[model samples]
Target chain A: MSERIRDFLRRRDDDGPCVVVDLDIVRDNYETFAKALPDTSVYYAVKANPAPEILSLLESLGSSFDCASVGEIEMVLATGASADRISYGNTIKKERDIAKAHAYGVRLFAVDCPEEVEKIARAAPGSRVFCRVLCDGAGAEWPLSRKFGCDPAMAPDVLEHAHRLGLQAYGVSFHVGSQQANLQAWDFALAMAAGVFQEMAVRGIDLKMVNMGGGFPTRYLKDVPGVPSYGAAIFGSLTKHFGNRLPATIIEPGRGMVGNAGLIEAEVVLISKKSEQDEVRWVYLDIGKFHGLAETMDEAIRYPIRTEKDGAETVPCVLAGPTCDSVDVLYEKTPYPLPVSLSIGDKVLIEATGAYTTTYSSVGFNGFAPLASYVI
Target chain B: MSERIRDFLRRRDDDGPCVVVDLDIVRDNYETFAKALPDTSVYYAVKANPAPEILSLLESLGSSFDCASVGEIEMVLATGASADRISYGNTIKKERDIAKAHAYGVRLFAVDCPEEVEKIARAAPGSRVFCRVLCDGAGAEWPLSRKFGCDPAMAPDVLEHAHRLGLQAYGVSFHVGSQQANLQAWDFALAMAAGVFQEMAVRGIDLKMVNMGGGFPTRYLKDVPGVPSYGAAIFGSLTKHFGNRLPATIIEPGRGMVGNAGLIEAEVVLISKKSEQDEVRWVYLDIGKFHGLAETMDEAIRYPIRTEKDGAETVPCVLAGPTCDSVDVLYEKTPYPLPVSLSIGDKVLIEATGAYTTTYSSVGFNGFAPLASYVI
Candidate 1:
């Protein structure tokens, strides 16, 4: 947390879970990646926060956006980001969605199969397409190979069909599973892409881009090693493999870029009796499953919790939302005790929930509206 | 479920999980419950589906509402439901929320603590009050005994304070756990409430209501013997316990009323091979974690999925969502075969999603927006 953030926290009235998106931290993260991976254009995945203010910040930073839906594309457009800077990348789309994207002037799209090619051809006949190849690097931990992307063996057929049909076909893209713990997965995926690129060359088709889909893990929980750095060991290998000849590279960083940049300051609604188990006692927060904290119960990711009033004094308490459901628990286990002597009226600020916590995950259950975000 | 729904599925040019709420079914459910529980006023839990249209149907059916947040109260009010007819029943609330509910003219509020009583007195002094009591139906599987509600022992003190403070204390409310399998649990809670009411009467405090908050089960899967009919057994016991002295009863029926009235329809985006599992197959749908289906996933509720086309062959398949996250699997298992051969373009509909699926539970994740409900 920055001194500015601490200073801001000191001044705000913590009535409920006030989502604070730190523009400074977001710019820092964006600058860090931009300075490190100068070769690739960053597409700030709008699915992370999509707050127009945050999207404007990324647009100011000159980052492109990878939108998976028409709503997201509209969010970016609402920020006055150009359509060319937005890629309609979710290949499996409805025909109406394809036409909508084209109507909105999204020229480039990701394609996974011949069926998708036919649909795209019908919807946006002149659109530039990227053939998504199923890379073997999708290991057991992450399973993108199952639902998306055409098999590498079938990519040639897709490329040929697109060429024969008059739909403008471009490069290849593959996601080596989302949030792969192993950095080698990307290397394996790139090598596989290289094979596909070579195969396309054999068939005399020219390619222009290679999109490495977003899955860069955000440091949600502490001591979880931050995403594999974009420094020498990784980007150096990328330059070594594709060389300067590597297609204009694109990386969608959703959680990694913005996950740690925000926090929700929620009021303590009530405190139950101390638990007999070593597990921390629970303090029910005023915000719940509706306030973008759905991932806490669903993904089991612990949002670092602390008492904003006195950060040093903390005890382990399983923070729960006010929903009547049992699954509304935000963190099953944590060291943060209910700020001692805290009553129903006190405030507890949850840390590092900047990513999927709110914008994408506010299942507005229990009558709570999706919380309003304040960009600090 | 209906031929019209089947026709809608046949006419869909694009596919994914789309839920349709039958207004007629909602009205029927309301009538069924209303007829069964005559003296009781049915407060349709807006947390089930706060869609204005759905709420309007319930409101038109002469049902009151149980609102847990200001948003839900606002949604209910938007349907022209009187504020007095809606209860801001979330025991855990912020000062602003209490004030908002008061501003919205919601006079009936629930409080779990003396501090909350003080706040309510200060904020909405004239509001009708219900003391939330912790009815730990012993040996029952309910988890909410850990949060909200004063123990029966603490109730007198709280009630005494409310009476002394000149707050309009009226009733008691307790939530049995969701999908409460044990109907005996109601007897235990009512017995406890009866004792509390008698003790309050002795203290010269008059009570007007005993809200048995929602926990009524919905039969989504086939195996569960179905929600124990709260008919003669439970209400008859309540009538015997309270007799002619019983206040107007309030039941927050969420799943029971609406669960069977809605169906989520989705198109099979992909049918892929699983590597390790036996003949692993996945049918990726449009609705991901962003929809209310996430609740079904988190709760481990089995949603029956069926494929529909004009007239086609059927097949069995596990359903998944479009999000890149592996946890976005909708169904880890399906009992019956899909109604038709689920090609990449085919559509599938999951039944019994009316209650907590779309209305209260949807975050715009993976760039996927919340699905809108159409009244059929």
Candidate 2:
């Protein structure tokens, strides 16, 4: 945890659980990305953590924004970032929402199908459009399904459809996956984008940019390759595929930008076992799946936890949230190891919660307030 | 769909998706439960949908509340219901929250372990506490895990611990499961409760109540046994197990009370295939798992969807929410079939969404507003 977060928690007198984000970590992450991929533009994914503080900080540091909706576009514009710096990154958008984003001065959009291209062509007239191709997302902890992208073979037609309707067919895009661990995952995705570029070239349409979407992961239980490593691999792949005719590149980093910048402090509410023969104890916390830990669905994301009695002997425990819903259990299939001496009312720290925690929190599930956030 | 909701939708000029709840359906459901189990008290679970209109209506109908937190207790009390009408039903709670509920005159709580019983004893003094035992959750669409309850064999000691403290050991509680289908599910749970009652009687502590927790099913894509069948089955179990010494009974119904009373109307954003050879079409909606349909996680709850072209030829389609997140896809593992004529911008109706939709919505995931609710 950052020292700023530690100091904030030490002085906190709050009644419920909360997350504290250290802006210094975010700044450092941004500089690392900038220095690593000096030629590519960094478009911070607003959906990751859209706190105004983080947006303003990135804006001041000359980072662009990848917005998923008109609401996110407005948030980026509120940071005084020009519309040209904002990309409507979500491929599935309502036609009315596309019109609203167009009115708000956003001219860049992502499309995966001809129907979506037609919507943008009518609503955002002369907007620049990027066609997202499918990636298997094989090595991602939270592997993406075939939901967001179309086949790479179909992308040329989607862009040609956009070009036919007075829209600018500007580029190609693909996401390896979120929290991706494999360093070479981007190479295969880039090869697919290069095929799309070649197909578009056969049609006399020169694609200007290649949007290498977010796959850079944050450190959870295991260490991830640094941004420099990702940059070296991506640059190697770009040079191998494009030769001297390299396209302008853009990278959207959501979790990698803000994942480790925040920490969540929660209290142990209760600890008990089902029976005398039960080998595992159940640890109940003040926060749970509905509160902010929704990523634990199917135990996909295992976050590191710490307590005051950390050095004490530990036991395998089934951790859960303080909700009446049965699905509120967090770690059960694979039990989380917590201190055996962990008693009721003792505080516990959940690490690497900076990116997706606050936004995934339910409005008032089981009558608990949304996760409180403080940007230090 | 109810004519009341249809009229509401006909008159609505608002943008974006919304859920409209017809209070008449809720009233009918409550009356059915009352007539079915004439001897039992109905404690409406507030976590289902804590809208003020529903709470006030239920309060006016002389219904008690099963609240999961102090905030829910406050919401119930705001409806002018007396403190005696509220039970702190969640087994996991902080000591300070227990004190707050005690200060507000709530005298009943649920517990599964000695640690929790000690907390209630110290904080709420002579409040009545019920011990929840574990249920296998057999034949349940949304089967509950061993998260909220202790083993059945261990309940007597927990209540004995409560009795040793200043707290009153009132009775036992168990949830068969949410959306439980089998009529015999309650038979096994009631047998377990009877064993606890016999154990308590042997200890010279005559337990006066048996809190049969909620597992009542609501109509979704399939027809479930009605409230009368559940009532009859439970009564048979009580008579057979208790031998005419039946305890005062309480039923907490969250989904059964409100699930069928509301309908969500959403606009189709896009419809596309991943490839030219792909057979299934992906249908994206304006509202998704984050917006309020969180029950669709794992496709466990298959909500019945309706479209204007329902009579047309059908094809299997993967439905998704319009967000950048890949996990937002709803019915993918087992694709839901839709009319072949369904196209972008067409209105689709999601039925039986009253219970868990509104509260499950994120604050603003992907910049989309929380699911709007209207009680007519």
Candidate 3:
């Protein structure tokens, strides 16, 4: 945990679970991305954590924003950032929402299908549009499905449709996946994007930029490669494909930008076994899937957990949230190894929680309040 | 859809997706349950919807409440219901929360382990506690894991511990599962409860109540057994297990009580194919998993969807929510069939969504507002 978070927790007098984000880490992370990719622009994905404090910090640091909806666009504008700095990044959107974003002066949008392109064409007029091509999302812990992007072969046609409807066919974009460990995953997607660029070129419609979508990893239980490694691999891939006629590039980093900057401190509510013969102990915490920690669905994102007795003997325990719903169990198929001395009311710190914890929290599932967030 | 909800939709000028609940349907559902199980008391599960209107109506109808947390208990009490009618039904809880519930005049609680019993013994001393035993949740569409309850063999000891700590060993409780269709599922659980009751009798302690936790199904894509069938089957099981020495029974129905009373009207955002050669179309809706349709996780709860062009030719389509997250896809493994004439901006009414929809909505995930609710 960051020293700022430790100090904040030591002085905290509030009850219930809460997440503490150290702005220093977020500031440092932004600089690392900026230094790693000197040419590529960084559009911080607002859906990761839309806390106004984080947005203001990133805005002051000259960072752009990638918003999923019009509500997020307004938030970015509230940070005093220009509309040009925002990219409406979600592929699926209502026509009215597109019109609203256009009214707010957001000129850049991400689109996959021709139907979406038609909506944007009427709503945003000459707004710049990027066609997101499909990636298999291999080698990522939380791999994305085919919900956002279309086939790589269809990108040219989609952009051409946008051009036909009086919208600027900006470029091609693709996401490898979330929490991606393989640096080589981007190579294939970049090649596909290059193919789209060539296809667009053949049609006499030049795509100016390549929007490389976010797949950047964050350190959890296992260490991930630094941002510099990702930057070098992506730059190498761009050179290999484009050969000296490199297009302008943009990278949307959501998890990588903020995941390691936050920590959640939760108290253990209860700990027990089903029976005397049962070997695994079930540890219930004050927070759960509905409150926060929704990323633990399917145990896909195993967070690194620490307790006061971290140096003590460890035992594999079934971790769960304090809810009546049965699906609230965090780690059960593969039990989480918590300190054997972990007791009821003892505080446990969950690291690497800054990205997707706050917003995913239900409004009042089981009457629990939303995950409290504090930006230090 | 009920006439009341249809009328509400006709008059609704709101732009975003909203759920309209017919209080008439809820009243009818309560009457059905009351008639079917004449001997049992209905403890409406507050986690199902927790709308003040629903709670006040149920309170006026003489229904007790099964609350999962202190906040839920407070919501129930706000309806002017007596605190004696509320049961803190969650098996896992913090000591402070237990004390809070006790201060709010709640005298009954659920416990699955000795540690929890100890907490209640100290915090809410002399309060009645029920032991929840684990049910395998077989034949349940949304099957619960072994997160809430303990083994049947361990229950007698748990209750004895509560008894030893100056707390009343109330009775046994078990959930067959959510969306449970198998009528015989309750047979095994009731038998286990009977075994625990006999053990308590052997120790000269009389357990008074058998809290049959909710598992009753709502009509979705397929027809499920009605309340009368479930009531009759449960009564038979109780007779077989208890042998004319029946304990006072309580049925906690969340989905079964409120599921059929609500309908969600969501607008189609976009409809398209991933590729020119792709056969299946993709249908995007204004609302999704993070909004209100969270029960559609794994496509387990397929609510019957109706479009204006329902009678026209149908085609298999993957349904998704309007979010940047790829996991927001609703129906993909088994693509849902929609009308070929269903176009963007067409209204689709999702039926049987009243129970779990409103509460599961995220607090502005992807910058979308929480699901709006209207009870008439």
Model 3 reproduces a share of the real contacts of 0.96
How do the residues B1-376 of candidate 3 rate in per-residue lDDT, one tens digit apiece? 9987998899889989999888889999999999999999999999999999999999999999999999999999999999999999999889999999999999999999999999999999999999999999888887788898899999999999999999999999999999899998999999999999999999999999999999998888898999999999999999999998999999999999999999999999999999999999999999999999998898888889999999999999999999999999899999999999999999999999999899999999989999999998
Cα distance off (Å), candidate 2, residue B41: 0.3
Candidate 1's residue-wise lDDT over B253-284, tens digit each?
A: 88778888888886666555433233445566
Q: How accurate is candidate 3 locally (lDDT)?
A: 0.94
**TM-score of chain A for the candidates in order shown:** 0.88, 0.99, 0.99
Model 3 chain A lDDT-worst window of ten: A140-149
Model 2 CA deviation exceeding 4 Å by range: none
The positional error of residue A144 in candidate 3, measured at the CA in angstroms, is 1.4
lDDT of each: 0.72, 0.94, 0.94
Error of 2 at A359 (Å): 0.5
Candidate 3 lDDT tens digits, A1-376:
8888999999999999999999999999999999999999999999999999999999999999999999999999999999999999999888989999999999999999999999999999999999998899999887888898898888899999999999999998999999899999999988988899898899999999999989899999898999999999999999999999999999999999999999999999999999999989999999989988999999989999989999998999999999888889899999988899899999999999999999999999999999999999
Q: Proportion of native contacts in model 1?
A: 0.38
Which portions of model 3 miss their true places by more than 4 Å? none
Candidate 2 docking band: high
DockQ ranking, high to low: 3, 2, 1
